[model samples]
Target: MTRSVYVTGIGRGDGRQVIELGVMELLTRHVDRVGVFRPLVHDDGPDRLFDLLRSRYRLTQPADSVYGMGYEAAGTLQAERGTDELVSHLVDRFHAVAREYDYVLVLGTDYADTNLPDELSLNARLANEFGASVLPVVAGRDQESESVRAEARNAYRAFDSMGCDVVAMVVNRVAPADREAVVERLAAHLPVPCYALPEDSSLSAPTVSQIVHTLGGEVLLGDDSGLARDARDFVFGGAMLPTFLKALTDGCLVVAPGDRADLIIGALAAHSAGAPPIAGVLLTLGERPGPDIMALAARLAPGTPVISVPGGSFPTAGELFAIEGKMSAASPRKAETALGLFERHVDTVELTKRISVLKSDRVTPMMFEHELIERSRSGRRRVVLPEGSEERVLRAADVLLRRDVCDLTLLGEEEAIRKRASDLSIDLGDAQIIDPQTAPVRERFAERYAELRAHKGVTQELAYDVVADVSYFGTLMVQEGLADGMVSGAVHSTAATIRPAFEVIKTKPDAQIVSSVFFMCLADRVLVYGDCAVNPDPNAEQLADIAIQSAATAAQFGVEPRIAMLSYSTGTSGSGADVDKVRKATELVRERRPDLLVEGPIQYDAAVDASVARTKLPESEVAGRATVLVFPDLNTGNNTYKAVQRSAGAVAVGPVLQGLRKPVNDLSRGALVQDIVNTVAITAIQAQGGTAQDAPSGR
Candidate 1:
């Protein structure tokens, strides 16, 4: 049976879309196939929430299959054909989606339309009819703490009285100071889990694009990323340039008469100077600046949105103030904000257990990424990023902090990191910043390094200078247990990132050599490719150790371990030194661990394709279903992983070093923000004991 979660709001202004999107994220983390169904929707062009989910979560369920009926139609049907008939039609449409997915996230009706007098009752009835456990959201936008608690209790009771399986209650849009009190009060009264999310001003602040849509304005400048900036405040221009400049604040939209080129130029110039980065400039009174002025404005603030509207300044101010920011496909940053807020406040593990979605048989790339984040959060550990000054690292740090995945210590000059983060408009909340040059801990780190390397070196002076380097500082931190792990190489070479680890952390007692694997996330599943970034060449014994470590690493993650030792030949079809090496490695693996599934001297096609396996090595269990592919050498492994990554569009998430004393990972120099985030999460998870679970059959 397909499990379903119905996210229903008690009334308007509840901001249930946050709850809905959060639930969708949690669902995708555990299951491969999750569906979204809106039982009732407004006739407003298109459903923004569903579009956001489809784009953000990469939903394959067609848009036509997601919605049952519009509000007007649903109301008409209920009035004419009775509630039972109306629900029956909706249930049929819902099951059509439910049957095709592992879990269905049913979006309950929005209370925007006033014609539906008993909207809560209708949502409850629909949830019951669809056999979904209810996750009700209550609005607390302007309510007192006691009032909000009362409403949450009443909402839960109302759903329970309706015979709906009320799984949790989410009190959203509450005042930030009142959030704790609201949750405490509700917890005492409610029978199920309760999550109270403090209202985020960003989620409510309008974007430049949203303001444009609201006023039917013309965009004279800006890119998509610029227009996505939140309009936190609206600053109307009427004074002199200097006087008006002082009124500017970060993310404020500058509003003025279109003829006021002085104000426009001043605002753009100030924005260019980064005194306070304004969202955009809004021109009103049915005018646009002259071409010369507009061209100068372009140079002053390139890619900053300069919008012109026909309405007068006063009316335009009203419309801009009324324009609320919405989470949609175009504004992904807001989705990240929503997910971050949701994850921080809610106990997702408990909620997911209550929702009771079955574990998926297939793990898609998105699922794997989601699981990495969730697992990191379960037992949070501190992972330091040595490349703290890098933009990608800062952005990834913002995401990690927002999602509350793991504690972070970024190594760099504190002032430089803060300035860079501010320039990027990234909020690095509570992330510890350490400057290796000025940090007081550097002295202690130097002493420790000298003690550890005294056998090779003679003086503490050399160790002091060496520990000043960011990579060495980070590695020493890990060795001394100041931090759990470290992720670097975003702006450095792979050797610069991992060499300090080999020197200080060293390999585990049972391991002979350290190796690495890339979690090759294909379209449908994840595969582990070993020694892609570490070893250049290996003898039979070292190759066998790599395969064994790779298999253990694969099983540590959710990927099942069926070891594939790659060579130029399959079975006895061809013979070479390379084939002989792989053949011997396979025998060594089998001799050491008979419990592990092992195959070698196998061609790539035979290791992956069932038909090729049947022809080449019939009745071999590990021939075609290999999840852990151990290449004969680094030359083959590196090129193969990169080739597949480019041509097949796979997400290669590692060079995760196994057999280390503590968890430390390396990133590619061209790593994106998400790649860094995943690597950091992998480091944190590895720090949390990296235990292997029972292997399930691979997809």
Candidate 2:
């Protein structure tokens, strides 16, 4: 039976990281269930705190971070001084997630001053609410006895009143020489377990298999510690997605990037509804796991291992990733990261066995489990395809509004809108439609008729009539503050779509120009090619800016920026106006931003071909490989990029509108529904605000 065990702590110092790390450490040892509780999350958002914990413990559930999480109001709320309410609320959240798991670790706040009375109340309350035991690890200058003993006594005295016997106070930060004395004193005086735990800043990762296999170890406690289970000469191997998923489908341990834990968590959560413990977790970051996560892991397996990496998650994620990724439904990364992940973590037999299980599942379920999890958790994406008829615009209006992509105001009559949608077998149940004749912007335009309109718009009635079309009304909506942005090029020319944005939205105060970027994804990476859709032929200054900005974007997306300014020749092999332009642009870029690594006047082969690059420009910053490619002209860039898009069978995800105050975009006249959906998601992500980091870099 799973019981919610909320772990509470009174700290040796700022118990935030230590308390969290300790709870996470304990979470790995439990076989039942667990949850995390904090009196207050300091000044941080409760959701953010939970997110950090979730990231650490490999939590991938679909609910918001706050769901199954308890929170206390900011301290200014008076009455119980907030801490009291926070404690009460945290207890509730603990019990909630606890209902699903076996234990919950409740950590106390780092109370400044000697607020022993309030701190005492909080711990006692935890025990009363969740029947939790207090684990007060007293930390000091050096887990010394004399310096920390007095505080330990006070902490113990506080817990003593609540029917707690001698309290356990583990001395923290002790000098090596003092370790023996500290533990001896605490054990002698304390009524309970007073074992001293040293600062384990870099403890080695121990596997269950290792525990089962070790020959000369003393079994201190627990089932595996009993020296009963047989050890294995197990080896992990393979780097196939199908095979990886098979190991993950049931209960097998896997390691992956801390960032991608959600991928693992989501899959395990879904599978656990039917199957056994899917696996343990190896998070490749120094992130601390959350209580909710401890609970989730316990639900799936007897216990899941949660370990943080030494260097960092980004570099260490290869341990188990490649093998498990093969089993994931979407297979987000190319096989390189996966294979590297698997080869580095476990050995051959384990890999082969995992693959066999995955292949067998393929025949049994005929479905990829990873994909189902991703689909269920993926937020719905929406876009405005205000075409077909006035009714079509109306039908798509509400979806646009609710998605918050842009507030849509359609141009049509209510009755006629319904009639047209009915005729076309469309649905318009959720649109905010207004007759263009009655549109406020159109009316204002009409009132200023003669002065702004052509000879065709002489009278007020004529002005109102001319401005009343759906296109005219949509344009008006953009002009007003009614929409964040708009995208309507389908059934219209690029001119029609762009003309409105330029006229209404206009450019930013200092934006001298606006350009476009095209993304090309090959087998291993996605390359960003720029200035293909905008600026027919840019001057050297503008070209330099594009190069600098594109490089910045590359850096943002985990790609090291190596910019290549491409021309037909390598260096001075050709002499022409175009070559001169490319040379000048490259020179200006280096001169303006000397720190930026840049190279140019290189042939495409020199820029992209490693061998050719070695021969022509071995010392160049970009040399053989560049993340951002700057072409000399639109003709070459536009045609080459389109050819790559078509022939490579690669996803060309953009002309993703760049340099926007807000992410207003334009849709291609002919785009599929998937295209529309992806664009909308990208736009929404942009609206959330992005730094250069969101840019797509080489995988």
lDDT of 1 by residue, 580-642 (tens): 999999999999989999998888899998899999999899898888999999999999999
For model 2, what is the alpha-carbon lDDT of residue 641? Answer: 89
Give the TM-scores of the predictions, in the order they appear: 0.89, 0.42
| Candidate 1 global TM-score | 0.89
Instruction: Note the clash tally of each candidate.
Output: 0, 40
RMSD (CA, Å), candidate 2 to true, equals: 24.5
Looking at model 1, residue 269 earns an lDDT score of: 85
Best by lDDT: 1
lDDT of 2 by residue, 226-289 (tens): 1211111121213344454555533333454445545455534533442323224444444544
For each candidate in the order shown, give its overall lDDT on alpha carbons.
0.88, 0.49
lDDT of 2: 0.49
- The lowest-lDDT stretch of 10 consecutive residues in candidate 1 is 690-699
Q: After superposition, how far is residue 172 of candidate 2 from its true place, in Å?
A: 45
